[model samples]
Target: MRFAIISVTKEGQKLASDMELVLRNDPTVIKVDLFHKNVKDTVSNLFNDYDCWVAIMATGIMVRIICPIIKSKLKDPAVLVVAENKKHVISLLSGHMGGGNKFSIKIAGVIGAVPVITTATDLNGKMGIDALANQYWFDVKQPQLIKAVNQLIAENGKVDLHLPSRFRFLENHPLVTRSYCIHIWEKSFIRASLPGKEFENELDLYPKRIVAGLGSKKGVAGEQVFFAIRSALQHLHLPLERLDALATVDLKKDEEGIIDAASKSDLPLEIVTLNEISDFKHVDCTPSKLVQREFGVQGVSEPVSLIRAGESSRLILKKTAYNGVTVAIAVSTN
Candidate 1:
């Protein structure tokens, strides 16, 4: 995680410098930038750039400066306020989704200061939905409902949680029995209501487990490839955000259309070599005559999706041909 440490006073600057040294040594931290000059402007300009902001100043001063620039909890960087005397570190904003609470505790531990986290879920020793999403890398489809779901958990009200089978351990949580109803999530859950139930408190969390495999004609436009992938996902009633990555045969590694589509979606493209595909004899897809003759592989989209999805991966959507492109999707077991 990238961090920006800002301080105004000399004493605070010294403390910020010390904190930066400690944070920089931490493996999880990627970079740390210290700023003692133009405090307000620095904070405003770098607010969205870094993952977290450690302000070595009074909480009131930090609050006043950030008030205007504060955005959604999901988009805003975590803000931590530390006293100039180094007595307390407070989680000022974006406690859960932005990791302010966790970052504050880490900073306090290294600096020997008390960590002040006021989020009700943390205080009550219950896991918030936002925190769970962060932990497992799940995308919250309706971030607006996070507050309502967490409020139910905090107040000991019932919250029905639908999750993938791999995440069944969450059912054993201390608060799960009293405040949550756990159900195995299925694709059908996306389009229909559960039988004999009206779960008004249901919260859906989409795990980042889907990988898309692409096969496009030469000189095809990136827009067409992207549209095919999006349309395939929509047919399954899954949000485009749930797509984790893109995959294609190594033969197309330099394909501009595929590369452009991955870049536009901000997802990594996994290149699977034809040798690897041929050596693996577990593919369940039928061989395409043209693909076999040209590429010496049964298919591009199906095998590539399975290989990239890792062990025990299964196809959710088979090769579906679109205009100048073919799209396939698979669920990763991991």
Candidate 2:
């Protein structure tokens, strides 16, 4: 996650510098920027760039500055306020969806300060739907319905919940199951029919378990690979956003088309070594004569997808050719 630390006073600057050192060492943190000059302009310019903002200033000042720029909770970045004296770290905005409350606790622990999280679900020892979505990396289809679902959970009312088989572990969470009526979904929620009246208050969460593997001819256009990937997903009735990552052989790691396609989708591309593919015992895909002759491997797309998807994974789409590109799809059970 990216973080921006803004401070105005000398003491606040000192605290911000100290926090920056600690956060920079954290493996989960990607980048941290410190801003002590042009505070208002910096905040306004970077409000959407960073994932979270740590302000070593007064709560009222931060609130007034952010009020005009604040958008929906889903799009806004997490805002945290730390007292200059280092007595408390408060979650000021986007407590659940933006991960402010969770980060507040983590920051407080690092600085030996108290974390002030005022979200109702946290106070009552219940997990909010938005928090759950953030924790498990599930995409919430209708974020507007999140409030109603959480409200029912907060009021001790039953909420119908639909989850994929891989996420069944959440059914046993003491806090999550307190008011949840769990049901397992076998297919993509997009392809599922509308729920009945009995499930009027249902909340469906889509886990990002799909991975696409690509193999393209030399000098293939990035648009061709990208379109082929989208067509493969559409053939399986899977939404484009459900894709978690892309995979390819190490031989094609320098392929410009593959790199550009992954960049356009904003997804990580996993490169599988030829040695790993050769030694892998699970090779159910059909052997490719051209791939075997050129790369010394039976296939590229199928094995790459299976390798990247981890254990208990199965192919949803076999190696299919699209012009000069080949594509395959895999769903990870883990």
Candidate 3:
């Protein structure tokens, strides 16, 4: 929602000024920070500090300077460039699919620059898979899935949308493509006479599911917790998508593993109060004394909320010495 713009010309600054005014007023635009001048060292130092970054300078250096920084981070913000003439606009990468595309178009309209949208599917009105994935919190790492969707649409005139389970619709996005289908598939697998099952292959495109929880000591290093948590999940054949969310106390704000894991999985943490957790019925858990005295009701708060959220945990992925740094796998009741 935040953008950083770079410019070296007075005209460019003026244009950025106009765009900033429009962007500030636009509800969609959260905050626009314009940087007209920067020392090479300063630019290098504060490069990765914003959510979304825009390089308006009409030079090859913008892309070069931004690319390495983007690649270095686990999650990269959208990047785009505006021509000095203000006539041509280019979305170099992470355009509409990742959000940079939408930002590019909006900026283009405000500045009167021609927004050059080059994504084939966006141009064709086929489902914008990346944007949809972003919206639905689906793990869209499979390029094959996106390509398959596009390929089906390209060759067959339309692609089918089939889901085994229907989460509530988030919004009616203009870019989302609707295909020929009588009805969508439901996860219940009960309806004998549903709409159609022709799109099973499409539904199988994504890895099924993932569920995870966070446990950490007050001072546990985030990197350490993440390493152990990820290692345990990998050991148990769990994809990051299976991660439901993190559960933890209110105190630890520096919980790197919880923050990083949720960001990676696009799942938010579900907090539990200490009072609620004090009522959880204890069962035979390993290292009984350690887990009981330190992890359950009396010790930490995240687990009870996680349990209350209908995350029926099937496995404690990793046995932890600390209550705050634990990662758990929830059962699939459905």
Candidate 4:
């Protein structure tokens, strides 16, 4: 992840340089830039450019400069404040979703300082939804509700975890104390159940499980394609959040409907040409005579899904027809 280190003093500059050198050698540390002047104005402008910010200055200064530019915790970059003496590294904002807490600890270890994390969930030794999402590569739907769900854990209120039989071991997480219920997987629900004391308050987490292959008609509206995909997933008892990406033949890479649906859902779009998909044709597939005559391929959805899913994948849902669209689903092997 890219990090921006803003130093405001001579001592802070020296420490920032030292930390930059140490982080440069770490494979996980992608890019690190040090800024020494015009911090109040320049730092906020770099908010969207960097993944995290390490400010070698007073916490109050960081707070004042960051508060106005502060956005949703889900989208903001991790903010950490460091003392010039290298004695304390405090997570100032976006402690979980922004990876501030973990970044703080690692930076502290390198600088010989104490990592001070103020998030209640970390301090109390409970896992927040953001932390859980990061661990499993799950998307946190409705991030606004995360605080309400975490508040339940903080108040010692009941927070139950309902896992599918395959994931029942997750019930052992520290936050799941009073409630541990193994559930059947053949249901429409996500199976990632984090319910608060009041049933209305809940945290919605979804795994990046399925790849959706789409074939849409020319100039088709995204709403139609998106609706078809959601309906297919619903019919198969799969949560839409489990959709990791959208796959299609290269011809449809610029298809308005496919591109719009992927963009709206924040999913990566993977496309493959007929040549790349031809290699997978021998790998058990349903043939479409009409599609073969028109597109020079037996199938678009199924083969594209397999290609995007890599070698260790299975075709879970064969091509399903929808108005002006064809859809298929593939899952990676466990």
Q: Please provide, for model 2 over 1-334, each residue's C-alpha lDDT reduced to its tens digit, 9 standing for 90 to 100.
A: 5789999999989988899999876534646899995778999988998879999998998998999999899889999999988999999998988889988987898889999999877888888888877654466767767887777677766566666664566677787777567778776541112235544544556674677888999988889999988888765545565678999999899999999999998889999999998986553366799999998888998888888888877566777788898998776745
Most accurate candidate by TM-score: 2
Predicted structure 4: lDDT: 0.76
lDDT, candidate 3, 1-334, per-residue tens:
5577777778778877777788665433435688886724444667655545566676476756755555522246666778767886677666644566677777788888888777776676655555555433344434445555555554435544444433323123334434223235656221112124543334332422334545566566556666755665564434444455556655543566666655654667666655555565433122335546654444442253336336443233323333346654443322
Residue 35 lDDT (model 4): 94
- Candidate with the greatest lDDT versus the true structure: 2
lDDT tens per residue, model 4, 226-279: 888887776444556557788999899999999988888778999889888766
RMSD of 2: 13.5
State which candidate, 1 or 4, has the greater lDDT: 1
What pairs collide in candidate 4? none
The global C-alpha lDDT for each of the candidates, from Candidate 1 onward, is 0.78, 0.80, 0.53, 0.76
Q: Candidate 1 local accuracy as lDDT?
A: 0.78
Which scores higher on lDDT, 2 or 3? Answer: 2
| Candidate 1 lDDT trough over 10 residues, lowest sum | 188-197
- Stretch of 10 with least lDDT, candidate 2: 190-199
Candidate 3 off by > 4 Å? 39-48, 72-74, 135-144, 154-157, 164-175, 178-183, 188-334
Quote the positional error of residue 42 for candidate 4 in Å: 2.2
